[model samples]
Target: MRLSNRNNKPLFSFIYSLVGIIFILGVIAYVLEISKFDVFGKKAWILLAIPSLLFLLLYILGRPVFEYDSDGEALNFRNNHILYILARKDAKDEFPKYKLLKFNIINVFVFKRLYVYILSKKNHIVILKYDINYLSKKQIKDLKFSLNKVVKANKEIRHEHEDNTVAV
Candidate 1:
């Protein structure tokens, strides 16, 4: 199965553009005396500060475009800022299914992360993290279902192997 937020690009773009326009209009209104309100005359800084703060807040909390694929023997995941190069945080990873030991989902405030535990060739446990903030509730459920299947299969196989081995 494959999941992605690529189809929501237009909605994201519209929100960004709306915020930008609000900021520009606020600046113009303050400079051109378009409003007769006393706040604009005496506390003009409010106009500048409000929109600036809003843009910064949105940037910090903005969701990234996310993708997950579990089509073959490996699971693939990716995350890139919806605004593209404006934010340089992008991640991509692929790991085989057989090595997967377990997985976890962490949600705090507006942020979410998926932690995958895998067994390395050297018998060390490796932890992989992926951003899952952009995924919807249903998408997250689906992802959890997929990971659970793999982890369960891995555990059952290990148990079968253990049952076949005898103490020497």
Candidate 2:
């Protein structure tokens, strides 16, 4: 199964465009003599500051697109921002199902993340994180369901191995 929120790109773009247009219209109105409000002249800085602050707020709250693929023998997870320049390095991880140890989903404020724990070839535990802030509640539920299945399977497999092994 593959889950992704790439379709939201156009929606976000539209929102950004609308905000920009509103700011431009405010500037145009201020320049025209038709303006009578003192706020536009005496407090004109508010007009500029409002839009600038809005843009900054939106950028800070925006989250990267996330994808999870579990169709093949390995689980693939990817996180990348639509605007790559402001975003951190993209995160991508693929590991065999059998190596999965545990997984966790953490939510702090408006941000959400998925932490996948895997056993490395050197017998060390490796943790991979993927940003999942933009995912809907239903999508998050489905993700938890899928990861739970893997966790349960891993636990059973380990139990069988322990039972079959001889005392050291």
Candidate 3:
């Protein structure tokens, strides 16, 4: 199943709006600082502007144009111009297993964000946080399906191995 951000207009629009807001705020801050002749404030405003501009540019330029085949051969993210050749066998071996699952949906006051979490075997926790407002429904659904499948498959395989060992 190949999936890409080819037709996610809503996501694109949301991101554009966000970046636009950031840029507008930056510009306003810069103007205010300049009007007041505060060198430090102006510098800070410019610094803030940099990330907003970079994110906006990247969203426009690095939008996923292609996706990987189901066989996990290669991934062409951002654009078909950049190919990420994956050694499927080697990559699968590096997959992480979750020791525990615990998370809460918290709304971020600033960006209104929601995040997920998973506890690792090494006593470390992993957070699955992202700007969901900037993602299409299709993208979100596909990601959920993929993650569930991976977790299910991993659990089943582990159980099978354990059962086999016990029978020995």
Candidate 4:
């Protein structure tokens, strides 16, 4: 299935946390002004503002958009109108590409931010993340099976095609 930033909890948590922090800072500033405290100078103020500003910028830009098949055979990534497709086969199960260079999975968290990396023989690399990518225990197992199947099938096909003299 396709996944995007909409309805993602991590993005919401980030935005809300940033706003909350800024609000807390504002309260502290008001309190300091009320107390007439000069202990924290301009440098301290600048340091405090930097993180909030960066978080605001991130919130404005929004989260990255991601799209992938639930079965893990194909993927499409779109950012700023640049679409990248990382598919090794068509619907007919034919090898559209010569070889898949490498496929790696990196776990960022137990239930969030799963990383999938794809490299092709033509020097193409696709890095995808399932940010806030949560699934049930059963769904996770299914996804694992699908991913393993795709990787194994593609590797065997690539090796067989590279070695023509070997009999079927």
Once all C-alphas are superposed, what RMSD does model 2 give against the true structure? 3.8
Candidate 1 residue lDDT tens string, 1-168:
888887887887887888889899879877765456554566777778888887886666545677888899998878777675456567787888889999999998877888889899999999877777768899999999988998999999988888888432
Model 1, global lDDT: 0.81
For 118-147, candidate 2 gives per-residue lDDT tens digits of 999999999988878789999999988888
Candidate 4: give the clashing pairs.
Answer: 1-70
**Candidate closest to the true structure, highest lDDT:** 1
Q: Which 10 successive residues of model 4 have the least lDDT summed?
A: 81-90
Residue lDDT tens for model 3, 1-168:
455554655555565567667777777777767787687753666646685766555443432332322335321122231213211111111124343243343334323222445565686876643333344457656755654555576578779999999999
lDDT of 4 by residue, 1-168 (tens): 443343455664565566667757766775675468666655446544765676554444333333345334444432221112212222212122223333444444433444455664566775544432334455455555655666677789877877875764
Query: In terms of TM-score, which candidate is stronger, 3 or 4?
Result: 4
- True-structure lDDT of candidate 3: 0.48
Provide TM-scores for the models: 0.76, 0.76, 0.39, 0.44
Give the winner by lDDT: 1 or 2: 1
Name the regions of candidate 3 deviating beyond 4 angstroms: 6-70, 73-131
